[model samples]
Target: MIRKIIHIDMDAFYASVEQLDFPELKGKPIAVGGGGDRGVVAAASYEARKFGVRSAMSGVLARKNCPELIFVKPRFQRYKEISQQIRTIFYEYTDYVEPLSLDEAFLDVTQNKMGNPSATLIAEEIRNKIWNQTQLTASAGISINKFLAKIASDFNKPNGQKTIKPAEILPFLESLEIKKFFGIGKKTADKMYHLGIFTGSDLKSKSQDFLEKHFGRSGLDYYHIVRGIHNSPVRPNRTIKSIGTERTFEENLSSEIFILEKLEYIVEDLSFRLKKQNVAGKTITLKIKYSDFVQQTRSHTVPYYLSDKELLLDIARNLLFQSKLKESVRLIGVSVSNLNSDQKKKPIAVQLRFDF
Candidate 1:
């Protein structure tokens, strides 16, 4: 039987909430983030987006794009509260819900609580309920699997929804831009363009062997996705195996001081997240990716769980020095695993954002 999957994405979640709560901010260009020179934009209102302002862009750059852009500090607590309200509406339909982030999730409605049979109606109802309860709009995409549903949701965004019936999958995918396909980042897309694969149809022309030869294992994924085939299930009650953050610098860093500075930020973010979740782990893993794209990970397991920021930084520092760097470092990451059972079962999404 065909599965029914729906991807729900709150429209400009943080920015939208700001608008809804403060009518003065509505229809204006605004960004949710620190307004400092070193701070980054967490979210940008649609008005700000027109001027090329985007999330993760530096606040200074965002301001240059739209001098009128209003920067507001993030209110994670309020956002979390609203996220719960939205999740409650999702549960009214199905237990098989997978939250990708506080602002987006995937719901499996093939066998739902309402037994509605129609994923379209379920998405519609859920969006309606979210708007009614929170005065915020959401975009939804419905299809046979997670990938297509996620892509579809972005098609007509902001209070819009779309469904890709099984028969329509091929043509729909064939017309999509290669860059828009999930898992294909800007770097990958540039490579695809150079290979003359600009769209789904272009990608579909390559054989499995050809794709695998070019993209390694991920080539197989591209081959199937371009043909509208994704079998990954909507996993519910999914345990977060690990929580981590990583950054790829524009210029490779050879200086130890610079590397340690970056590690400090990564450790701070991880520590705050662990505290928010009220969880800790005994294992600390440090990952480094070189300028040549060679990746390596080193892990240390302590006797007791640790969540202290300073302690994590110390461990990361030791791991960094103990390992020999083959080349200049391009990216670095820190993760904690072997979490407590309570944290593993905790129903919350931990989002990892990486800029290419």
Candidate 2:
């Protein structure tokens, strides 16, 4: 049976939230993130998009491109709260909800408990509900599978919805450019262009073996994506392979005190999150980025998984002190991995729904 997959993504999520909270910022080109030399854009409003500003673009370049761009410091704490608010909204439709990030998630509503037969209409209702509850706009894509739905959501973004029925799959795929294909990064897309494979029709002509030989595992994915086939599920309650958070600074700094302040904040957030999820990790990783954009990470694993914030903070501070950077620090991120074994508690599958 054809699956009903819906991908819901917020429009310029961070920037939009900033605008909603600050009325004066509405209808203005805005970027959310630091505006200093070392900062990168975290989110760009629709008005900012007109000036070619985008997420992850250097803040210095963004200013050069859009002289009037407004930058706001990120409030990840608030973003996380809003994320949970939206998760509650998804549960109203179906249990097969898979969150992709803070502002987007996938819902497998093939058999919804709400008695709604049309996934497209369900997406419409969910979008409306999000707007009503959070005063934020969301775009949704409805399709037979996750891959198609994800692409469709991007088609009409910023408070929009797009549907890709199975019948329209071939034409849709044929008309797409090689650059837009999923998993085809900039480097890979350029390689495909050189190989004369620029569209679905071009990709369909190649055999699976030929694709695997050229693209490795991704080649097989590319071959099937063109045919509108992806068996990957909207994984729910996905194991926490890692739990961490990071933020870009407004300016490069060598101030250990200021960095420690930021680290403490993230540690608080991580501890609260892990405790809420009832999971702990044995490995701690410290990520650092320099003004020159060089990034480095250091990790240590312990014998026992622990959720102690004090332990994590102490080790993370030591890692930062040891990381000698040629340039001032531009960003810092923290993460914990090697989660505690699950043999102590009931399996997540059972705890999640209790179906069995």
Candidate 3:
């Protein structure tokens, strides 16, 4: 039995939401984030993307890429509200929905409540419902498994759908560029190119042992995914492993006094997140990124759970002063792990008939 998975991804979610709410922003290149020298692009509208503006790019560079790009502060609360509304539409079709983030998810509608057999039609209907309710467009991909579905979803993006029938899977995978595989990043792709693995067919030609020798444990994943074999199921209830927050400064700090000042706000933000989730952790970790891009972390575990801002700040301060400053620091982060929440039970996978 084969599973029918549909991957639904909202088109430039944050930027799109901004454009939807502000008519003036429509048909323009816009970025959703701070516009200052220290600011980072959280998301870029389609128009901005064409000019090489992208999420995580520095605002300075984004501006250089497209000077006319308008920057808007992010409204996370509003995005969450809209995300929830979109999720409700998904639940109407299937219960096996695994959310990747606020704007994308995977749904196993092999046995949908609507008694619908065609995952493609269900995807189309779901996209339609989202547009009708939120005035937002979503792209979807339907295939026999999550890996294929996820890649297919991006084939025709920003209000489009694609279906990869079982018979077409092998040919599609063979023709796909190695870099286009979901988990293969630039560095990995470069390494693969050096190894003559330029396409999925090239990747599929390598033996598991050869791949493992070169790429270690991840090599096995590459071998299987290249052949369109991904067995990971759609887990609807993913565990919250940690709650944290971080800030990158426009200017690096050289003194402990200035670093501590930044830690105060970082700890406060982490506390708010932990409290919002009604979860606390016994371990607190501090992350430091130097101006040169070198990173380090210091963690301390307490006997009792902690979520209060004062307590987190105390731990963060200790972690910070635990060692002398290596160099000018560019970013600082605080995270709490080892939460007290109960682990969710794993659902048993059911073999279902595929109609795609």
lDDT of 2 by residue, 23-50 (tens): 9999999998768875667789999999
**lDDT accuracy of residue 138 in candidate 3:** 99
Q: Give candidate 3 regions above 4 Å deviation.
A: 243-283, 286-297, 300-321, 324-355
TM per candidate comes to: 0.85, 0.75, 0.80
Off by over 4 Å in 2: 243-298, 301-336, 339-356
Candidate order, TM-score descending: 1, 3, 2
Report the CA-based lDDT of candidate 2 relative to the real structure: 0.82
lDDT string, candidate 3, 223-332, tens digits: 89887788888887667788889988879999888888778767766774675456799999999999999999999999999998899999899999898879999999
Cα lDDT, model 2, residue 324: 62
RMSD of 3: 5.1
For candidate 3, the per-residue lDDT at 338 reads 95
Number of residue pairs clashing in candidate 3, backbone atoms closer than 3 angstroms, sequence gap of 3 or more or interchain: 0
Question: Which segments of model 1 are wrong by more than 4 Å?
Answer: 260-282, 292-294, 300-326, 340-356
Q: What is the C-alpha lDDT of each candidate?
A: 0.86, 0.82, 0.88
